[model samples]
Structures are given as structure tokens and as C-alpha cells.
Target chain A: MIATRPLYTPLDRIGWLNTTIRCVLALLGSYANAVLLGSVIAITLSMPAKDATMSAIMLGFVVQLLAVIWVFYARTLIGAFVGLALPATAAAVVLHLLGASL
Target chain B: MKFDKPRSLRKSMTWVHTWTGLPLGWLLFAIFVTGTLSFYRLEITQWMQPETQQASIYDQGQGLSTATKLLEQYASDAEFWSIGFPTARNPLYQLRWRAPEDKSGPENAKGKAKSNAKGNANGHAQGNGKDKPQRGSNNGHNATSADTAAKKTNAEQSQPAESHLAKGADGDKIKPQQGHRGMMQLSLDPATGQVITPRETAGGEFLYRFHFQLYGMHWSIGRTIVAIATFFMFTAIITGVIIHRNIFKDFFSFRPRKGQRSWLDAHAATSVIALPFHLILTFSGLLFLAGQLLPMVAGAAYNGDPRGFLRDYRGFGAEQAAPNPNAAKLVDISAIALDALKRSPAGIDSINIKRPGKADAEISVTTPEGSLFSGKQSLASLQYNGVTGDFIPATSKEHSAAETIWKFMLSAHMGLFTTPVIRALLFLSGVLGSVMIASGLVMWLVARQREREKLGYLPRGHRLVEQLNVAAIAGLLSALGAYFWFNRMLPADMVDRSHWEINGFFAVWGLCLLHAIVRPHLKAWREQLSLATALLITIPLLDPLTGGNFIWQNWLQGQFAIIGFDLTAFALGLGLLYATLQVKHKLAKAEVTKAVPPASR
Candidate 1:
């Protein structure tokens, strides 16, 4: 849904700048997303703090990996940014509501 | 920036794989190659200092007697004494000890160990309490080995090589050691328990340390760099799998002599074959640095003090030493070590004696490494009463599922807690991983061959890649070969001898980079590979001629580690030789094609 084919079919070229921006967005965005995701898991889990911290960290790795792929897999910049930002925003809000001090 | 149309996912992922894989691929290659070689870190170290070859498997009775006698003489007043038995990995029994803080000479700023005699000495072990995540798993995950392993890299980087101080020459003050917190290590012959001064060679410790934290930089910096690369590597692997499009087919498929396709085929085959290993190692590698990489997880969870998480996770609470004036004769530690070794399949890694001479003294004997599911470095250590020498069974703690999985990954990455066969397999898989990275790098250059040919010249960027590939791949091998050569060439009595060995390694690597920059790309590859091949093939020769036991002697003694080290060196040499010849053939073929018409038709 994020990728709409532009009407002009002849202008199909990938620019280095676009790719770089995409990379920066993906790495930083995915990282931000993963941290919040991990923090949430660490707080919400009903397990021991040590176990929760370790497990959340483990899931963080997977989340970051998937977020990176999603950024690249998306057809547009808006799509990539939104893909990471939406989840990250949700995670942050949930973290706040849970009364966990950041 | 010009906008590009939305591309297919496959195309997009290919770009991701290419960029992520290529830019940092050289660094990754170094990490992979060294990490692979580290599967036999102890064996290689054993081979490097042939003097340690006299050591054989631990004979609990006689070995312990000798070790006990040495400890009595050398470190009687030590706050801590650690004795590590000879396992299949490290055939030498290693001894380490720390002077009490109050006894630290010169405000502890100038801690130094000056051994009474000349021989190979191990210094700075990986401190289990710190630098856990930054350590290579193979650094003898046992307490003693960890300390031994940790201090080794410290010796490589900062301090001059240290030897155990002569009884009368003990310094008034000693500097704190790195890794295992500045513990001093001595190599003891398993048979006689006499100290064997191993040559100050680079040993396997240099490469093992280099693989994780690099050299010549603060460990945290080097570790962070490695961590970042590992993150990139994880990204590459996921993208690689996504972009593969035919993972199962790639597993079964291999194409040779097809240039770009051949390179791609090799990459795919190796990647698919060792897919599980790559995933585990990369992720576990990340987890090792997880405390730093995602401190927020610990910070948020443990109220901002990450140390709290570490302390709780490691189960290390302060143990106050009981000061009992009553003097009791300590029982036989050898028996305890042997008994514990039998019960714990990992074998005895280290025996730490705290307040060793007093009635309330304690002896904790740990197995080689932690269990697959336990968070602790040792699954359950066998403790003994210092004065009475009574056995103390460890209270087994229940492991949660999450902790179990987390610990399992960490233990698996350490590559301990396994039979020799499994270690060998891991080594082979590491070799495959190295190949996978190498081929991927070469394929990138090969994929651009057409553009170069059409332009009749190499672009600046392409030329840069060419030089890096040659230097990082064949050149690194050459440097490694030189390190072994230097180990043999350097005199044993040279001060800071192992440091000299490490210096030779960097020196040769720098020379290789220079050579790569100057020589023609193909010739450079051929030359470096030839040198590596020559060095590797003849490494086994140094074993006997350079004071190490012969392969046959090692075999008769059941020291397969030495034999394995020799044969592996020879095999790697032969592999490099094959690669060299291939490059030579390509060089010759290109010459012919250039001489002939551009197109015969």
C-alpha cells in the first residue's frame, strides 16, 4: 500500500543519494525501534528482571534485523520511515503508560 | 538527489546485501578468518611455543603434587591461586595468582611480574568478572583459562611480557593486569609440574584477541568497532538469506570455472551449508556485546545501573574471607580436582584457592566452562573446605526458560563443553564461513568485471576494492604465516618476547597492505597467496626443529592437538597454494587473450 507506481514509466533510476538516505533511515530507525521494543519487553514480562532483560535483548536483535529489512523492502521512503516510526511510537507510548521511568 | 522508481524487493535486497557486505566485508573477513583459526587457539598456542609440547594430559595424582609444591613455593602468600589442568585443548597446566591488594607495590600503579627463570610464560587471562562479552568463546571458558586468556591480550597490547617473580626479586609494587585483573600465569609441564618457559611468540592468543577486540586500541573501542561490524554482519546475513531466492537449491548447487557464477555459487554453497553457524555466531557475537550495544535494556530494567544486571546475572556477591587463626593442614587438592573432573564432563578448568593456608580457607574447583543452560561460567563448581578439604556440593539454581536460552547461546559461542570432534567440526564450519565471506567479496569485484573491461580500465573505487581484497584476504594469511615464522626466528630470552611476536604480525600485515597497493592486482594475489602457502606448508617443520615435539611423538603421546595444528597448517597452505595457482592461471590466460585478437571472429 505504501508503494504506488508513478505514472511516468521512463524515469526508472536509482540514485546513490536516495539509497544512502534509505540506509541511514533504516539503520537508525530500526535501532530506535528495537530499543523501545526491548525496553517494553524488559518491563512488561512477568519473569525475573535478569531473565526479562536478557530475553528482551535477544528479541531486540531480531526486531532490529526485521526492521532493517522492512525499510529496504518498502518501495518508498515514506513507507520505510512510517514502518519503523509507527511501531516505535506505539512502543514509546506504551512504555510511558506503564509508569516506567525512561 | 534524483528520485528512482520503486524497485522489486529482490532487486532492493540485492543492493542492501551488496552495500552492507562489501563496505565492511574486509573487516568481517578478518574477524571470520581469525575467529575460525581460534577454534584451535590452545592447539596453535601449544604449537607456537614448542617448549609447552612436553606437557601432556593431566595425570591428577602426580600433576597435582607438582602443582601443589610449586604453588607452595611460588605463591604461598597469594590472595588467590588458580591452577588449570591440561585438557585436550591446552596440553599445559597453567598456574596463575594475584597478590593481595594491600601488598600491591607502588600504589598498584607499577605491578610487574619478573620470573626467576627464562621460558614461555602466560600473562593476563580473561577476567571472567569483566570483559565477558568481548571475549572469544574459545578462551578456555573456565575461570583460570578465562583469566589466562584475558591477561594474554593485555600482554599483547600494553605491558611488556611478564614472568613470575623470583622469590627474593618480588617487586615492592606490581601493576594491575588486564583481563583476569592482572593475574600472573605460568606454564607448567603436566608430567613434572616444572615451569616451562614458552617462547614469547605471538602464539594463538594474538589472533584470538585480534578477532574480537582488535589490537593497538582501547579494548572498548576495538570491541565497539567489532560490535558495529557484527551488527552489519547480522544485517548482511538476514539480507543474504532474503536475497538468496533459492536457499535450498543453492545448497545443492555449485558451479565451477564460470567466473562470476562460480564465485556466486561458492558463496551460496558455503553460506547455505554453514547457515546455522553463521546465524548463531553473528547473533551470539551481538549478544556478547549486548550489554554495551543495548545498555538501555539493562538500564531500564535494573534502574540504570547495568552493573547490577551483570552482578545479578553472574551471581557474584561479595564473599568475605573468614579470618581464623587456627592453622589446619589442607587436604590433597589433586584428588578433589580429579573427582570434580570426573563428575563434570567438561573437565577441570581451574582451581581457585582463597585464603589457602588458613583453617577457614576455601577451594573452588570449576569445570572447563559453564553448562549449556546455566548463566554461570561453570555449571556447578565443586567446592572444598580449605582446612578440612571436605567436598562442598554446589547448590543448583533453577534456570528460567529465557535465562536458559540466553546462557545456552553464550555457552555455545564459547565453543567449550564439547568433545574434540565437535570442536573440530566448528573449526571446519568456521573455515567455510571464511570461504563464504571471501567468495562474496570476490564476487562483488567479479560482478563488476564487465564494466571494467568495457571501460578498458579499473575505476578508482574498483581499484580500491581490489587492493583491499588482496591485502585483507591473501595478505592477512601472509602476515599470519610471518607471525609463525617470527615465533621460530625470535630468540626465546628476548625481553617482552611475545610482544615482539605480535609486533611482527602487525609489521608483516602493514607490509602486505603496502605490497597490495603497489603490485598489480592479480600478481599481488598470486604473490601473497604463494607466500602464505609456503609459510603454512612448512609450519609443521618448525615443530620439531624449533624445539616442539614431532607429529609422530605427539601422536604417541596422544597429543592430537599438536598433530592437528600441524596438519591444519599444511592443509591451509595447500589450499592457499591452489588459490595461488588459480590466480597464476588466470594471469597467464589473460596474457594470451590480450596477445590474440580482441575477438577471434
Candidate 2:
């Protein structure tokens, strides 16, 4: 989405230009991605297993770590899509395989 | 610095408030309106469920007695037996049994597994006497007491705290139990333990579902949406305050006259005056649920130690457990658990026994009472040897002061540990907040119309804004009204009643949008809002027609839940009617003034 009449002002644009905004956004992105991914994993794992407590806790930790990394490095929209999609796809496949084998 | 405000300061504040409010105004408006309606979710549910109308208010004493009997009937050593006392809107006692177990299953799953699967069909207190100890099911010890079980009564004059417990087995010590669970409310006849009113049938449940689509998708996704919406809402409220400079002057400036100016003033007045409340509610809502939404930040920031993180934010500790799968049978639940909980660090109002009939199982009792905003304070779990009947600690360390602070903040924000009177106040305030948002949206539409007339052909910017206004305000109102209709109209015996109810909510909302887009903007707003007004007004009327009455026949019998619904519906109906009249007057005046040319005078 291109800027529709520049929501940011000159001062506001400068504020975004400041290094701190980038860092904050990056951190927030990483955090958000990790939470989103982990939550997805937690929920998906919770589906089949009669006991989801342990899985929810463990998957929550691992996914969060991965999400943080994805947020920091993945800059473009395409990158973000891949960053979110890849882990989710991988997790689903693995979980399905685990369910089948069990 | 002199505190006196200059014109520049006034102008700057106005700019600040406007910018702050504009971006997130739409989302906040949705939140406020939905949330306010959510306050009477139970009442709405009662109005919807006609079958539950007669048996709405369960006898408290009878309910408690039945729950106790059910506890004994299910498992003598059930780790916890929690009961939700009946409220004005939902007069049903909810009872749940928790049993201690090992990581695998209940302690005696192999041999002593009593087939509760059979007793499941013995629903709604059929008086089959099947629970009266059959020849095969009965052990040697039969302490089944049935005296005065049906005649449990409550003195209306007693204190709220005193009312929760029956005269103890000894008629001395008061037993603490779980209070109401708002969103997940299910009405059951305290007399029969049969599902008198399923939560799926309740109106509040739809709001709960809408808030978090507990459907095909995962909870995390819903939580994230709710969180992001809350974040945007906070930002908008803050910006709104900054953008409106002359906020105080417009506090009482509501002109119930016909014009866009009048609309703008009303909207500005409500939002500005209650700005502080709106901000507090949104920020606090996010804060209350931060752990669920922002867990990564919590985990990473606290360095993978869930305990540390909880300690810092929620005053809760990870309950550690040492599994003893081969323990003895559980002790008397009502007596043993309460005794142990009293000994524990935090006070206990609720207890959960996982893996009943197990050797190594946990008995987790929590006292969430008075622990709001403290994150996870008032949680103390005791893992006991189910076989040996020994108490085991869930965690070693207690919550720190900082964690407690976080818990308190959370509790206060959501009014978690508050009394009924305070909760009612909060609920009222929530309604006001919703009205404030609705009025604001209307004001924007009114202002744009004036601008449109001046510019001719309605500027693209104005048209887009106006369309969005119709879609959000009118569309949302119609959807909400439809939810009530669905509740009353849907087949009571429909399979998957809960799922269908939620589907109905979204379906109606979708239809509203479709209708709005096709219809003229002005007509859609008036018709839908007027329909909403009628539906709200008719809700109370439906009660008596559908078996619920506000008269002595119901109220004298302690059927407060149904009566409360009728009164609340009537109140909301009046509010909607007032708003509709205001809008109609404005439209009338605008048209009349336009028709009469100034030169004729």
C-alpha cells in the first residue's frame, strides 16, 4: 500500500527516521511474529493430543524464539509472508506426521 | 509554568485529541458498543432462551446441596467441587468436578474406574434414585444423606458473603466457593443438574464468541485480533483527547435539535467527558490480557523463566509438582482441600483436582478474589498423593511485590475482584462509552453531509467516509439486533445450538453490510437503527410472551434472572428510541430548512 497523502508529517517522518523507531518496530515485529507463530503451533498441537498442556507450554517457547528471529530479519511484505508461512507449513507437516505415527 | 491555557495551547490540544481519536475511532466505536451490550449478556441470553424462563433462578441452597450430592455421587475424593452462584440475569448454579490424577490418567483408571459414562444420562435430577446407591455400585460405606435436599432456602436479608455457604456440616465455618464466570455462563437447574439453559443459547455467549471466535480456528488468532484491536482503540482514545481542545465547553452542549452541528456537539461531548474512562478501560483491558497476547515479550524479556515473568507481571508462580502416581485415595474434598488451602500462602476460592483415582495427582486451588491486575496472583496449587491423601506444593516460591502490583492493575482494569455494585457501575460506564462512540460516528457523517452540499456531488473523501460510517454503525446495530432475534427464533433442540447461534451472529452482521452497500445511505441508517430500537424494546416484551414475566408470579418465586432481563431490555430500548428520535429530528430540520429558501423570508 503506497502512502495515501502521507499520514506522517515532516516532524513525524523525522521521528520514524530516528534509529529508535526502526528498532522498536523491529522488536515489535519479532515479538508479534513469534507470538502469532507460537500461538498457531500451540493451537494446532492442542487439536489431536488429549493432553495439550505440556505441548502448549513447550511449543509456545520454541515458536516465540523463531518468531523473534523472523521479525528482525524479514523486512519486505514478501519476506514477512514467507517468514510466517514457512514455519507454519513446516510445523503442520511435522505435527501431522507425528499424529499419524503415533 | 503558568497553568493558564492560551489560544495556541487550546489549538494544540485540539489537534492532539483529533489526531489521537481519528485513526482508531472506528475500532473503538465497535469495541465500546459491543462491550456495553456485553454487560447484559446474561440477561439477553435469558430473554433468548424461553424454556429456561420458568426455571431461571435456581434455589441457591438447593443448588449447593445438589452440587455437594453430585460431588459425592461422582467421586468422594474429587479434588475440587466448584459452584457458580445464581445471579439476577442467570439464576442457575453451575457445578464442576475435578479429580486428581497422574500424568497418564486417573489414579485408579485400571481397576477402580467407576463408569461415570452411565450416570451421564441421569440428567436433570430425574429422581431415578439411581444416585441412591444401587446394589452393585454401592460400597459398604453409604453416607448418602437426602434429608431436606429439596427444601434448601435463603434468607433475603442476609449478607452476600453469608449467603454463599449453607450452615456448614457443623453449622459454624463458612465455605468459600467460586463466583460467576461472565463470558462462559451456562444455566442449569440447581435442582436437577440437567442442562436447563446451555450457554450456547445465551446472548452473552455470542458476544464472547464474537470477541473470540472459539470456533474452527485457534484461540491465539482470536486473542491476537482482540489485542491489536485493543491497542488501536487505546491509540485512538489518546489521540481523540489531544485533538479536541474545547472539550469542556461542549460537555453539556447536546441540543436535541435537527442539524449536523447538534450531532457533532453530542458526539464530541460524550467522547470528551468520558475520555479518561475510555482510555483506562482499553489500556487496562490489554494490560489485563497482556500475558496471553504478548507472551513472547513476557518470556524473552524475563529470559525463558515463566516463573520470573509471571512474578514480574502477574504475581503468579509456576506450580511445581512431584508426581506420586501410587498414592492413597483422596480425602474428603470439602474438608481436606479447604484445610490445606488455608495453610497455603495465598487464599483459595477455587480448587481443581486433576486425574482422580490416581497415585500421583495435583490439587490446584486458586483465590482470584481481590487479586485483580496482579497478573496471576492468588493462585496456589497443592499436588497431593492421591493414594496417600498427602498435600504436595505446586510451586516453591510465592509471587513478588512487583508481580502482585501487575495482578492488581489487571484485576482493577477488568473489575475482576469487584463486588456486584461496583461491577454494575463499570457496566453502566461501559454502556456510556459505547454511546459515546456511536454518537461520534454519527457526528462524522453529519459533518461530511454539510461539506458534501457545499462541494457538490459529495467529495470522494466524504463519500468514502460516509459509506464506512453506514457500514460500521448501522451494520453493527442490525447484526446485534439479529442476534437477539436468533436467540428467540432458533430451534431450541437444534443440534450444535451453540455453534449455530454464533454462526447466526456473523451471518446477520454480514447481511447488514450487504444491505447497507446496496441501499441508500440515509435510509439504511434510519431503518436499521429504528429496527434495532424496536428489537431492543421488544426483548422485554418477548419475555412474558415466551414464559418469562416481571410480575409477582415469577419474581415472588425468586426468578430474578428473567425479571432482570426484562428491566434491562426496556432500559436499552428507551436509550435506542431516544437516539432514533434525535436522528429523525435532525433529518427533518435539515430537509425543512433546505426547502425554505432564505430569499422568501
Candidate 3:
């Protein structure tokens, strides 16, 4: 009987490093996503300014959790980065334009 | 690139869970334990300050009048005055005031210094006679400071003290002072208008603050560290769920006394049993910290003013109109409370007077929300003319759907609105979280130790982890026991008594760490666990020694908080004792196995 070689070594140092990087990306990417989403909601809502801001902030956490999970589960690093960056950029642009109009 | 493979997601997540969870495991454990205790923060505070056992059952109107009279006597010229009404949990009317700017310095400093000396002398007289010399000198210092204060007051009485604010000659704009704000807080007995001077103790507030702010560090730094740890915890929980395939199988599985398998089973059971709570708590904790962690969004939107963002977000209307300089006489506060109660049957939670002394003083009476879980600060409030007591229409606006959901989430996380049973369930969930983290740390060491034994030699890193596991887990429990013991043992009037309690906690924890490093891992665990058990069990005994009513007495008097605390301590002590026995039995079994040869078996 032959013992099969494991795909990843136990306590692999490089594996640890990669996971750390992903963890950091998860935080940053999710934060960006939250901000973008929150801003859009704030702009679209017709409620009082404070309510709009609060609603955006609350919704932001849900978006953040989704973004973080996506970072870990994405097929490729570049794919994950691209996925997060596109929405973040779009939100930023929309928020800036709305602010200018105000 | 390697992690990008489809099959490697589980493996990669397993790796993530291990590293993220292990590194901050100890800190997360401490935070969870302290935070869980904070759920019963008010109860623990009531128990710790035993002197405040007497509850006042005064009528609301009488209580309000009493509070007002005390304020008038002590802080008539205060720039800002606020009163917090008594509740079932705390039967004292809390009054706080910010003195007019000019009176903040020198005089207040002298008063504080004199109070400190007096406190020290009192503590020395009450404490066991171990330091007579220090007590005598403190007494001397107290005498001198008292004399100086008397002389200074006499001199001031001869001539009017300098007024910080210029008297507004009818229709002058009263400019508020900047930079110099002197604040004072006093708790008054609701039954009698006199101040109730309870012995200074940190009580459960220490645990509440320590969970977030951690002691001896800048608040921001502490908050950031806690937030980062919480993020890792969130990550670990997610990764843990992904990596484990047999969630239901693990949930119902428990094979005790099976060594490593038993530990694994315990960990899985704890994590799975309260998985929802863990998720809610971790997510809500992050949301609670959203303002601090992700301030940029709000800062950018509100031009760097977080308060403005919060105000707009919560829909608090315009600030109270400025004080009417020409208006004479302040309206009676009791009238507002009574009038508001008549209009709204929900009862008043608090009353905020914007400009208490001036004619334009607007009194806002906040009505308590019916639900305990409602996140809003106040469900409804009515504003009234400060001088005439005529009701000004309610200014609190309706919250949007988003805001309402946000508030509900925050309140649900806090469990402040919940009944005692629900709070206990939350606390039990927290206890499970602490256990899950502890078992995970031990499981790591057990697995690693097995691997090292197969490889013939254990590395330094493995040994370090072993030591850390013992120290951080059992050692921390012992330190917590010590904190409670110190609360009872320390002199009531001791100077910096709260600081001493905190220091004692750390000192015991540090000693435990040293013990772990010096002793064998198993022996260290057994010893610390035993110490924790002894300390915890003896805690109830100290209550009697410290002049506190016995558990039975408190139980009879319906002071369940103290009784509950004592009983909980005893139960935890028994749990630790059981753990200690298990450790001893395992150690002895290991010795017997070593003595016998495998060939003979």
C-alpha cells in the first residue's frame, strides 16, 4: 500500500503567509465595499439625513461580511480583487457626483 | 496560486482557521469572559458596592423635588445640570453638573487633594494595623489641607469670588466658555435628599470597560486591538464552519474520557451548540465598533464630524435654542416630570434641560420605549417651555426602516431590554464561547504534541505554546478569582482602591504565568486549576468577613444579585475542582503506563 502525498504540507509557512494576505484583503476590500454601498443607499433614500446615514452604515456590515467571504472563496486572487474593486469604484464615483450636486 | 485550485478551498480555509484562531486565542478568550460578565454588569456592581443595599421607594414627584433641591444647593450656578431618575436596579437619583468655567481650577484641585488624604487616613484606620506610620502622616496632611480650605473659604466670603460669566444685561448674547469645564457627579438617596457616599469601587464597570478599553493603554489603541481580535474571531468562525464537514454529527457527539478525542468532541459541541449566538455576537460586536473601525465613510460624508453624522443619522432635530438672557427664573423640574407622565402613560425615562437656569431653557422629557430590545435612545419625547411648564410639541422624528433595523440589531446584541432569563442565556452563550476557544487552544497543543512525539523531539516553539496554553487558560481563571477576592479584602476607603484591585489581578496572573513557565505543563495546569477552585470557593466566605450580609441573609431579603453571584462563584469553583481532578487522574495514569513495559502488555 502506498501513502499518498498530501497536496499541502502541514503547518506550511507559505500557506500561512498567503492566508494572512487574504485576511488583510478581506478587511480592506470589505471596508471599501461597505462605504460604497452605504453611500449609495444614503443618496437613494428619501428619509431624514440621519436615518439615511444610519441605514447605510447598518447595510454596510452585511455587505462587508459578503465581501470577506468572497475574498476567501474566489477562484483566483486577481478575480477576487477585481470583483471588489469594480463595485467600490462605482460607488465612489456615484457618491462623489451626488455630493457635487448637493 | 496554489490556493486557487478548486479542491484546495477547504484545505486553505482549514489553514486560515488554525493560524487566525490560535494566534489570538488567548486574547479572544479574555475578551469573551469579561464581556460575558459584563452582561450582568449592573448586578455585579450592586453586589460589589454592598453599602448601597438599601433601596429608596419614594414617589417620582417627591424624588424629583429632592433631586432639584440638592442640585440647587450644590450646583446652582452650574453651566450645565442633568439628573438621572432612579430605576429598580439602582435606587439612587444621579445628579451631574458642569461648573461655570472660572471656578474649575485651584479651589477644586485643593478640595480633591484634601479628600485624597482624608480617604487614605480613613482607609488606614479601617485596614489591618500593618502600616501605622503612613496612617499618621496621612492624618497630619489631612489636618493641614482642611485648615487651608477653611481659611481660603473665609477669605473668599469676605469678598465676592470672581465670576467667570459676565451677567447678561437684558438681551445680551450669553457666550459659552471654552476649554475650562469642571464637572461633578453625586448620587443622592431618593428617600432623603442628602448625598449617599458609597465606598469607591470599580465594581463590574471595570470588567465592562476592560473588555473594550483594556487597562493602562490609550483607548483608541485598545479598541483597535480588540477590533482586530474580533475580526479574526469572525474569520475563524466562518472558516471553522467551512472546514468542518460533519456539523450535525459533531453537534451530537460526546465521547468523554477518551483523551484527545474527548477534547475535540467538547470543542465541537460547544462551538456548534451556540453557533448562532457566536455569529450574532461577533457580527454585532463588529457593528458596534463600526464607527471606530470604519470612520472614514462617515468622516468623508459628514466632513470629519462624527457627532454631526450621528445626529443626522439618528434624526435628532436642531440643537436646543440658545438660553433667553432676559428671561427671569427657572421653571420647577418636578412640574415637567409630572406633566409629561400625565400626557404619556409610558412613564419618563429621563429629563434633559438644555439651559436649566435661563428663560429659554427647554426641558425634554424622554419616554421609555415599550420594548427592551428597541435600540433607539428614546421612543418618544416631549419638549416643554422651561419657565412656564407648557408642553412644546414632541420634536423626535420617525426613524427610517434602515435606522429601525440598525437600532434593533444593536439592542439585540446588548440584551439590555431582555428579561433576567434571556440575559442568563446570553451569559451562558458567552461561557460556551470561552470554553470553545479554550478547548481549541488545548486541542492544538495535543495534536502538535502527538506529531512531535512521532518525530522524536519537541521543538522550542511547541514547548512555548504548551506553557502559554496553561498560563493563559487556567492562569487567567485564577486571576479573575483573585480580582473578586481583592474586592472583598481591600479596605473600603482605601486610596486608589479600584486601581489596587486591578493591579492585584494582573499580579496574580503574572505569577501564574511564571509558575507555568517554571513547572511542568500538566503540573502547572493542575496547580492553577486547584488554586482557582480554592479562591473561588473561598470568595463566599470573604463576604461574611468583609462585613457583608451572608448569602442566606441576602437571599431572604430578596437581594438576589449577591446571592446569585455567590452561588455562581461556588458552581464555577466546583467546575474547576472537577477539572483539577481530571488532570490529576490523567497524570497518574500516564505515570502508571510509563512504569509498565509495552512488551509485557
Q: State which candidate has the highest DockQ.
A: 1
lDDT of 2 at B435: 69
Candidate 2 structure quality by residue, lDDT tens digits, B1-601? 1111122433433433343345556656666666665555555555565555556354533554455454444444444334444545456654443333311232112111111111222111111111111111111011011110111112112322433343332233322221111001123464544434232343463463344222345545655666656654554465456456577688867776657777677667766766666766775566434555555433432333333433322112334354345545545555644565467544434444454545644444444333353333333334444345666654554444433433454445445556668767777777777767666666665655545556545555555555666667766776676676766666654555545656676787677777666665565667667877787788666656655574466668876656666677667778768867765764576467763222111
> Lowest summed-lDDT stretch of 10 residues in model 3 chain B?
B141-150
lDDT, candidates in the order shown = 0.70, 0.47, 0.64
Candidate 2 is scored at a TM of 0.63
Q: Model 1: per-residue lDDT, tens digit, B408-449?
A: 776666675667888878888899999999999988888987
Model 1 misplaced regions, further than 4 Å: A1-14, A98-102, B1-3, B56-61, B102-180, B317-329, B338-347, B368-370, B375-378, B595-601
Docking class of 2: incorrect
Q: What is the TM-score of chain A, computed separately for every candidate?
A: 0.83, 0.38, 0.73
Better of 1 and 2 by lDDT: 1
What TM-score quantifies how close candidate 1 is to the native fold? 0.86
A22-74: candidate 2 lDDT, tens digit per residue: 33443465454545444444345433221122234334443543443333233
**Candidate 3 residues A39-84, lDDT tens each?**
6875566765566666666677668767886777665565566778
lDDT of 2: 0.47
